[model samples]
Target: MAFSPEKSNFRSPLKGPPSPSWNDLLLKNKKALNHVLFTMHLQSRSNKQTPSSSPSPQIRKSLDFTLPSLVSDPISLLSDQILLSILSKLPDSQRNCNSLVSKRWLNLQGRLVRSIKLLDWDFLVSGRLFVRFPNLIHVDLVNGSLISLGECGCF
Candidate 1:
């Protein structure tokens, strides 16, 4: 009886118990393990991607690892409130610049801005304050040159 692997390279005419070759079993196990690992990777990725907002930069980096058309599910990314909080933490100049990154960002900017100060009102885009920060809870008007009972239209 040849029990060593090196001696079982050839088929024998005598057959007793059918023993599956080690190579064949290993190949099957390898494929199954690969599939299970891939499934685990996907599950873990989804769990980690649902963070408050750090994934913004991470996702951009992830896109470099995948094809442009193979993006992950957008809905599972993050909650709107968390994302808004993250945006609120950014500097005014940065947040305003990034507001044009996507439609989502544009909408988020409006809801995230809790307050703002207007100095030279005329220097701003007309109606831009109201349009961009419609949900702003508090706003300070500092244009000292124009202040009247009926002329505070910009405010």
Candidate 2:
């Protein structure tokens, strides 16, 4: 058989200088690349590390090498039931903060806060406790003996 490079199944890599298109792309996106690097550096500096939080699949796609806390968010990928379940573990203050993240989250947070703490029975009766917390299952009173509002209208 004759030595024929064209007939061979295998092909050698370019021995000549690399194409300038790659260089053009690099130059054009110099600022974007820097922004991506800086964003990644800040994210790395923070201690909270998770596969989703890392430069993983979703983040990479969203970042496209420029990802942040997501324009939509990967956590939204979770079912609301699971998301609410996860949110339920957070403290009241934390939950309150989380509620401000979005309307859907606010509704979930509201529904998950099944307990209410009141100064006394007066505030409980004065307020539409049931209407306020449709999912409320428990009430914590600060001072019980001194005064008691027998029955709230909302009940």
Candidate 3:
């Protein structure tokens, strides 16, 4: 007994007409298949050579070119009010370090100060204390020299 495609009642699962044997199909499209294979071989050879070859000036320039960074300062993105709110939640000891970050951070942190202990009446007289902390509601002048406050003319 021998197996044969023609003698069997098997139908192709594919949608098109039943396929012939591999030998018949290969014989029919041998020239077309050879052309396709030759083109593919040439393309693969060209691809293999490309990486070894020096790129053109235009291509080299394009490869060397870099785009500007999209990343920005995360602190700069937050609104002043939000930054102040965050600064206000910090502990008194940790709050001192926030001023060292940047001028913007210092300004934001200053706005969060509701009470300040005055060490020098000169600073208060110079008006820089009020300028730095515009939101201050309480000022502790106990540490300052008592005579300086009366002479400062801040009354």
Candidate 4:
């Protein structure tokens, strides 16, 4: 399989099976063998994407570098299913931002809202959060100050 420049030099950070040693013999020219194995890995990954799973060229082009960096926050970098697991534990402010980040996040937020308490004595949302989550059942106002509850149907 043809290798792209990005794939030609990839190296697994692991030292174990599923990555057999036969793929890179110690006696061989170590660097060249490593490059060959890396190429194969990339080829396999590319081939694994079925037509339905592959992004269109437009989508591939529209994705910017920041998208990956934003997602690479280690906790969030976990799989989407895993990210969904901890959404409620995140600060309310973060949940709002994550909700805006992508469709995946928005979908997660929809599921997560059912389980979220939405109000913390220490972190209250007087604006959009309150407006957006109208079903918020209870909020902690202890040791908190009042601010106008903007367009969220709050008093």
TM-score of each: 0.35, 0.35, 0.48, 0.28
The residue-by-residue lDDT of candidate 2 on 1-155, one tens digit each, is 68898778664476555547534854577667557555645465455666555655565555554444442443554568977887887778888898999888887887886777766565567766565566988877765425444554443
Runs of candidate 4 exceeding 4 Å displacement: 1-77, 115-155
Cα error, residue 70 of model 3, in Å, equals 2.3
Off by over 4 Å in 2: 1-72, 117-132, 139-155
lDDT of 3 at 119: 89
How many clashes in each candidate? 0, 2, 0, 1
lDDT, residue 121, candidate 1: 64
Error of 1 at 153 (Å): 20
**In terms of TM-score, which candidate is strongest?**
3
Measured with C-alpha atoms, the lDDT of residue 122 in candidate 2 is 55
RMSD of 4: 17.4
Reference-based lDDT, each prediction? 0.65, 0.65, 0.69, 0.56
User: Could you tell me how far off, in angstroms, the CA of residue 145 lies in candidate 2 after the best superposition?
Assistant: 16
Q: For candidate 2, which ten residues in a row score worst on lDDT?
A: 65-74
Candidate 4, residues 1-155, lDDT tens digits: the string is 78698757565668444543532543258555444444544455468888688767776555432243333332333455766766776778878887987776786776666434433433455465554444565554543544447735787
